[model samples]
Target: MRDALRRLSQGEAHPFDVSTGWDVVWEHARYPQKAVLGLAAGRLAERPLGPYDFKAGECRRILTRLGFAPVPKRSGGQESDDADDAAEADLRQRTGLGPTEKASLIRARRGQGIFRQNLERVEKRCRITGLRDRIHLRASHIKPWRSCSDHEKLDGNNGLLLSPHADHLLDRGFISFEDSGALLIADALDTRVLDQWRISQPRNASAFRAAQCKYLSYHREHIFLGRED
Candidate 1:
């Protein structure tokens, strides 16, 4: 499996008889290990090969290295319900706006049109993956929208253009950045999961302006998990 991955990284031909080389790796592994690797490889096979494919490939390598068992999946509906409840509670505490007003405000301030254009002025690419394509990037809030003041909702400094995956990590507080742009991973997150997701900690991001740094400070204080002085 290692040899195959090495060859793939070097731009060499597929090292196995079948295209699903990960299946071969899984077959050679022990009980629980097989299930984890098999799942990772299966995801890789689902996506078309491209520069974006690097993350999925790296996931397989990380899974192999860590040798951790797969985590149990949670129900989508239950998770969504919990998230909705949290968002509602946060909105009530921060904004004190009614549901209709909140919905309107969210629509107006949500990252699109002017907000997106403003983000482009500050960030040319994803800070993590360095992906420059506009289509593949999102203008994610540094301080979450539901928790922001009216002024902050539209502030360019309070936003970042991140790849969808990076945005997911940031929004969920699985990762954050320092004022100096160094990546910070939550202690609660499994190292293997971080590796599989290609989330590198202690990595510097693209340069941040002073205003962005202030907003980032808020994120570190309020959003980042396991934050320390």
Candidate 2:
């Protein structure tokens, strides 16, 4: 790195001793290393030190100034996201899906884009409050995006257009639905809030399609919190 800097600044390559380079590499590997490289580099700067001089930081600062960000150590959540991305890519490869189709699937994961459009086909409004305005409603997954297969993620029958509060409740296992479309209120939910949300007591969403009912069954089993007597 130092030799490269010299060549770039002075237009003459520094003679590199391979034996010395190997010796330094071995010393770094075996000995307790100290962070003196930057100070040493700064002292040996080819030109006078300036405000933006990366000679003080062993070129890391200059690299950043040139838009070359140093790679950070990945945390557990970052690693998980990377693994999920790899799995999604593998799925796309196996299914022969192009970038556009893969992108659609990714958007569907958040119940936006294709997923919202699909839900609009089957459900026109929020099931709980009967809110018809699309802009105010959320297309939420019955089996949830994280728990579902790729096909299930975009399944129209696996979703509902819910108000924000309703979606939050459903997602957090505070509410669910029966195949008969009867609302299943979790014990943890404060019943008083239902009135504020303009939801009636002993309400039923009427009935679900067979496909929707299939997904509802999964939601009731897994997401519906606090069983009845």
Per-structure clash totals for the candidates: 0, 0
- Model 1: lDDT equals 0.59
1-229: candidate 2 lDDT, tens digit per residue: 3333333334332222111000112212211011122223445765433323322223334433544322221132343345557766666676667778788887886788888888899998888988998989988889867567878888898899999998877876677887888888865567888877777767788799998988887776544553333
Each candidate's TM vs. the true structure?
0.54, 0.57
Winner by lDDT = 2
lDDT by residue (tens digit), candidate 1, 98-145: 776665445534477555666788888888887899898888889877
Regions of model 1 farther than 4 Å from truth: 1-105, 227-229
Q: Which 10 residues in a row give candidate 1 its minimum summed lDDT?
A: 15-24
Residue pairs whose backbone atoms clash in candidate 1: none
Candidate 1's TM-score: 0.54
